[model samples]
Each structure stands twice: as structure tokens, then as C-alpha cells.
Target: MDYIAENTNFKLKNSAVTLGKFDGLHLGHQLLLEQVISLKKQGYTAVMFSFSYHPGNLFSKKEFELIYTEEEKLAKLRNTKMDVLVSYPFTKETSNMEPEDFIKDVLIGKLDAKIIVVGQDFRFGHKRRGDVKLLQSLAETYGYRVIACEKRKYKDSIISSSEIRKELKEGNMETVNEMLGQPYSILGEVRHGRKLGRTLGLPTTNIIPVSGKLLPPCGVYASKTIVDGISYPGVTNIGFKPTVGAEKVKGVETYIFDFNQDLYGKFIEVELYTYERPELKFNSIEELKQKMQEDIAFTRNYFLKLNEGNNSSYSN
Candidate 1:
């Protein structure tokens, strides 16, 4: 996919665009993406348009963390059939743009959108004055069609990014993964740690998350680590290693079962499956090691049952 971020000088032709924050790219967001991608057969460029900053950041004083960072969002979209991704700069001026002006300048003028896809409740431009009705009203004048998709539902509630963030913060991995349409994964390069795990004979691969990346509560999780495109089940600890140095920076550290290979500086994706236990501060290194062993056993069994039909193994 072509990523256009902060740079929008060029225009795309015959595009089918979907606009949204796409923060988590949850199942709800996927519905919009699928709509745009479906237009590829009609000779339209599939484009996903979002702002460089979260739209809510303009009105709130608190820092906004994303379930998927900008890089992570692009990474996820690359796997799809979509052709283009736009992270348009969001400034005070753009936020105040009139609804019709956004459509004229962005949708038709810049993107040359032949088809516009959005959720039923989609709104835009100047105190959120824009709505599906407005977009539809101008469709004839703008020479583009509008596709308003219904919101995806999970049981009684709507599948949304806010709800997924809530479930993630509460350490409900199962529910979060279900709504996400895939496992909640942390993607980063394996960085060097203090080698404490190695000394304890439970060596791990560590990844320092990027700034503004939202994470679940610090805990041990039954996870699957993807190394070189192959997934291996493991136990991951997402915390600040309070038992050892009590590092100030939180990190994702995973011990791939039956795997022994150098991974420093290599990129890996750790997918959380189940929240196992809370992070604990042990008095001794032996105590921490013992607890880790128990976590590993539990995680192994969890994956075993999860993949019983496929005859999964713990080995890499």
C-alpha cells in the first residue's frame, strides 16, 4: 500500500475512499475498509483516509494513546487489498473547514473519489457539522457516490475502538481479540535487555513499545510470537521487571518455547491471547523464575487446547 502522510501534494485518480480515525482498525473499521477495497474490481483505487492526529486530540487536554500506532496501522493495512493509505495533517484550520469545502477540496478535488465509503454515523468538518445526509446530498453535485455502512455489532453492544480500548485496559484479551478480528499484537524490534532471563535459564526477547502506544495492564499473557513470518507459542510478560531492576520503561518480553536463536535488532510481533497473571515483585530471583515456570506451563497448555485440531507444537 502507498502511505501518504503529511504530504498530500499529489492527487489520486478514480479513487474509492473511506474516511475515519481508524485508530484500532477493529471489526467496525474493517467494514468500511472492505467497502473501499471491493471497488477495486470496478477500476477504482482503494484508499483509506485518516488524520495524522486523533480527531479527539484537538478538544481534549489529555494525551491520546492509540491501540495501533501510525506505523502499526500501516502495517496492518499492508496485508489487505487496499491500495492507498492517507494520514492527512489535522490542524486547527482543517478542523474548522466547512463540510462542503472538505468534500470539494479533499474528496473530489484531491482524491478524485468516484465512490466514498463511511459508517452510518460518520461526520466531519467544523464542530462535526458534517453527516451522512450532507455527504449524500452533495453526491450529485460532487459527481461521486456515497456508501454508508452499518455499524458492526458484538452481541448487544457496537464493535468500536473505544470499547476495545476499555476491554484492553481491563486486561480482557479474549474480548479485545474477538472484536479486533485478530489477536492484539505488539510489533517492534527485539532490543537488548539486562540478560536477567538468560541468567535464570529462561531467556526472553524484549521489545520497547513506541511512544503513544496503548497497552493492556502489566501482566503475563499467553502469547504467540511471529518471527520471520512463523508463529511460535510463548509466555509474555508486559511490565517493568519490578523483581529485578524495576525499570521505569515498560516493555514486552517473551520467551519462545523450545526456541533458541539470536533475535537482537530483529523485528518480531507478539500476539496476546489470554491474560494469565498480574506482574509481581518477588523478593528473590529464584522466586521470579519459579513463577515464570508456572506461567510457561499454563501458556503451553492454553495453546495446546486452542490448537488441538491442528496438532500444534511448542517448538519453533
Candidate 2:
């Protein structure tokens, strides 16, 4: 995938484009991308137009914590087979452009877009003054096509990155994973820790999450970690280790089962599968160790059941 800046003065012949924040690339965004990919197969170049920052963040006083940080968002987009990724920084002047000018300059003049795929409720231009109807209205004059994707659903609620963020903060891992079509994962480099787990017989590699990335509730979880192209069963703790002391600096410490090679400085991806228990401050170090043993046991059983189900399916 080729990444281009927004202000780049370049023109293409024909392209199929999708526009969105694509924060987490949730099911809804995936549906739109699939359409772009299909259009590319039909001979148009696939392009994705996204803002480096959320448009809403431009006017809001409160800082927005992204579901996936900007780097993570780009990483996910690179995995797709899109021809071009145009990322532009949002600015006051850009936001104040008229709907018509945006169409003529951005859609037609810059990208030479032949087709645009957007959600039914998609909006653009100054103060979100543009909608799908406006796009359709200008389609013929601009010589482009507009495709509106219907809302995607998981269970009763429509799937969205905002809803997923709220659920993750509330520790609803099961639903988060269901709507995401995969486990809720965090990617970070393994950092040096207090080595407290080693003393307790459950060694763990500490993780320092990317700044401004939203994290799940502080607790222990039945999780798995992927390292160097291999997946391993693991247990993770996300929070300030209350039992160790009163320091509240948040960190993710994961103990990989059946593996003990040093991992400091190596990056790892931890997938939270199930919530085991909340962060507890035990009265004694012995008590903490006992509870940690229970967490490991639960993690092991969870993977065992998962593997058993896999075997059962293959046998059938």
C-alpha cells in the first residue's frame, strides 16, 4: 500500500475510494473496504481516504483517546490490498471548505475518483454540512458514483468503534471480541519490570502500551500472546500491581506459559480472550501468590477447552 499526504498535488485516472476515520477498522469499516476491494477487481484503483486525527477532535475541548493509535491504524491499513492510502491532517481551513468545493477539488480534481463508498449517514465539509444525498446530487456533474453502505450489526446494537471503546473500558471482553471478529488485542514492546512474577514462580514480561491508546479495565485476563510468528498461551495483568505497592502507573505484565526466554525490548501482541478476575490487593505475599496460581490455572483450562473444541470439530 502506498501512503500519500493529503496536500500532494497528484491526479489519477480512475479510482474507487472509501472515506472514514477507520479508528479500529471494525466490522462496519471492513464492509466498506470490501466494497472498495470489489470495485478494484472491477478495474478501478482502490483508495482509502482518512484523517490523521478525528474530525470531531478538532473542535472538542476534551482529548479523545483513540481505540487504535494513529500508528496502529496505519499498520492495519497496510495489511489490506488497497492501492493508495491518502492521509491528510485536519485543519480549520480545510474544515471550513464548502461542500461543492470539496467535491470539485478533493474528490474530482485530486483523486480523479470514479466511485466513492461511504456509510448511509456519512457527512463531510464544514460542520458536517455534506451528506450522501449531496454526494449523489453532484455525482453526475462530477462524473463519479456514490455507494452508501447499510449499517452493520452484531447482536442488537449496530457495530461501531465508539461502542467497542465503551465496552472495552467496561471490561466486556466477550462482546468486544464478538463484534471485532477477533480477540481484543494490545500491541507494545516488552519492557523491563520489577521481576516480581519470577519470585512467585510465574515469570512475566512487562508491556508498555502506546501512549493515548485506550485500554481495558484493570484486571487479570485469560489471554494469549504472539511472539516471533508463534502463538503462546498466556495470562496478563493490566493495571498498577496493587499487591506490590501503591504505584498507579498502568502497565501490562504477561506471563507466557511453558516459555521462559528473556523478552525484554521485544514487541508482543497480547489478545485478551476472557476476563478472569479484578485486580486484588492480597493481605500477604503468600495470598497473592495463591491467587496468581489460580489465574494461571484458569488460563490453562480456557486454552484446553478451546483446543478440545478445535479437535472435536476436526474429528467430526
Candidate 3:
């Protein structure tokens, strides 16, 4: 997808667009994006209009966890086959625009949106005065169509970014994976640490994640780490190393099985598949080693069961 960072630099032809924060790119966001893709098949160009920051962040002092980086968001947009991605900078000034001005000046005049797909509860402009009903009225006056995507329900509850955030905050890996259609991931560069795991016979790669990214609750998890575009089954610990007396400082440590290479300064992506166990404070080095062994065994058995299920499905 073509990413246009500045609205002033965005010069695209008329297109059908979906507008949202798209924080988690959850199922509800996916539904809206699919509509934009479908519009593209009908000869309208598919575009996505998104804000660099959360809409609420402009109004509140409270900080929020982001589900994806700007790069990750663009990648997800590309996967939806969006022709253009218009990333508008969210600011106090931009937040103060009137609803009609946003539609006429920004949406119609700048983006040249032939149609807009938004959620039912979608609102914009000063004090969020713009709603679906207002958008429908604006569409009639501006000579464009409006598509309001309904809420996506999973197990009698609406799938939302907030719900996904809650699941992540609570360390509900299974629910998070189910709602996201994939494992929750964290991307960072490998950094040299004290090599405590190595001294304990389980060498690990340490990473410091970018700030503001949501992480799973502190625990050991079954994960897959990607290095140089290749994935390896691994076990990860997200905690302060309570066993090693480093419990006060948070850290992310991963030990990729059957793989050994210098990874310091290399960027890696770790995807958490399942939570194996919580961080524990062992009484001694031997106790910690035994627990580590158990953790690895559990991870191995989990992958074995996963592979078996996959093979069975294919063979049947």
C-alpha cells in the first residue's frame, strides 16, 4: 500500500475509504476494511483513512497501549489490499474542526472519498459531533455514499479493540489469539544482557520493547520468534527474573530451541502462542533449573499436540 503520512502530501484520485483508529485491527475493523476491498472490486479505489494517534488521546491525559506500530498498521492495511493509506496527524487543532467542515474540507475536498465505510458508533470532528446519522446526511449533500459497518459479534459479545486490550492486559492469550486471528506479537532488537540464562544452561536473547506497546502479562509462554524472516519455535519469559533476584526490573527473554547464533543488535519478532506458566520465585538455582526444564517440556508437548492436530486434519 502507498502510505501518505501528511494530509498535505496526500494526492490521490477519488476512492472508497474506511475511516477508523484501527488500533488492534480486530474483527470489527476487518469487517470495515473488507467493505472497502469489496468496493474496490466494483471499480472504486480502496483507501484507508487513519489517525497516527488514538482519537481519545488528544482529549485525555491518560495514555493508551497501542496494538501495532505505525509500520505494522501499514502492513495490515496492505494485507487488506488498500490502494492508499492516508495517515492524518491527530492534533488539538484537527480535533476542533466542525463536523461539516471535516466532511467537506477534509473528506471530500482532500481525500476525494467516493464512499466512506465507518462503524455504527463512529463519530468525528469537534466534540465528536459527527455520527452515522450525520454522516449519512453529509453523504446525501456531498454526492457520496455512506456504508455503516455493524458490530462484529463473537460469542454474544461485540469484538472491539477495548475488549482485545482487556484480554491482553489480563494475559488471556487464547482469547487474544482467537479474537486477533493470530498470536499476539512484540517486536524489538536483541540486546546483550547479563547472560544469566546462559549461565543457567538456557541461554536467551534479551529484548527491550518500544515504549507504549502492550505486552502480555508477566509469564513464560510458548512462542515463535522470527529472525531474518525465518521463524523458530521458542519459549519466552516476560517478567523481571524473580528467580535470579532481578524481579523488580521488567524484561523479555526468549530461548529459541535448536537455534544458536549471535543475535545481539538484530531485530526480532516474538509471537506469543500460549501462556505456559507465571513468573515464579525459586528458592535456589537448582529449583529454578528444574522449573525451566518443566517449562521447556510443556512447550515441547504443546507443539507436538499442535502438529498432531494439523496432520490429522490434513490426512482426514
Please name the candidate that would achieve the greatest lDDT relative to the true structure: 1
Candidate 1, position 230, lDDT: 87
Residues 1-316 of candidate 3 have per-residue lDDT tens digits of 7788855555566789899888878778888888998887788888888887777677778766888777667755665677888889888788899999999888888888889999999988898899999989767789889989889887888888889889998888878877776667887889988787888878899987766678888999988888887888889999888766674557789989988799999888888888988888889999988888888888888888877777322111
Better of 1 and 3 by TM-score: 1
> What are the per-residue Cα lDDT tens digits for candidate 1 across 1-316?
8999997687999999999999889989999998889889989999999999897787798879899999889888989999999999998889999999999999988999999999999989998999999999999998999999999998889998999999999999888988888888999999999999999898899999998899999999999999888898899999999988788999999999999999999999899989989999999988898899999999989877777755322223
Clashing pairs in 2: none
lDDT of 2 by residue, 12-101 (tens): 669999998888788898899999999877899999998877876888977777887776667667778888888877888888998889
- Which 10 successive residues of model 3 have the least lDDT summed? 307-316
Best by TM-score: 1
Better of 1 and 2 by TM-score: 1
- For every candidate in turn, the CA RMSD to the true structure comes to 2.4, 2.8, 2.8
Per-residue error for 76 in candidate 1, Å, reads: 0.8
How much lDDT does candidate 3 score? 0.82
Per-candidate TM-scores read: 0.96, 0.91, 0.90
Clashing pairs in 3: none
TM-score for candidate 3, please give it.
0.90
Give the whole-model CA lDDT for all candidates, comma-separated: 0.91, 0.84, 0.82
Ranked candidates (lDDT, high to low): 1, 2, 3
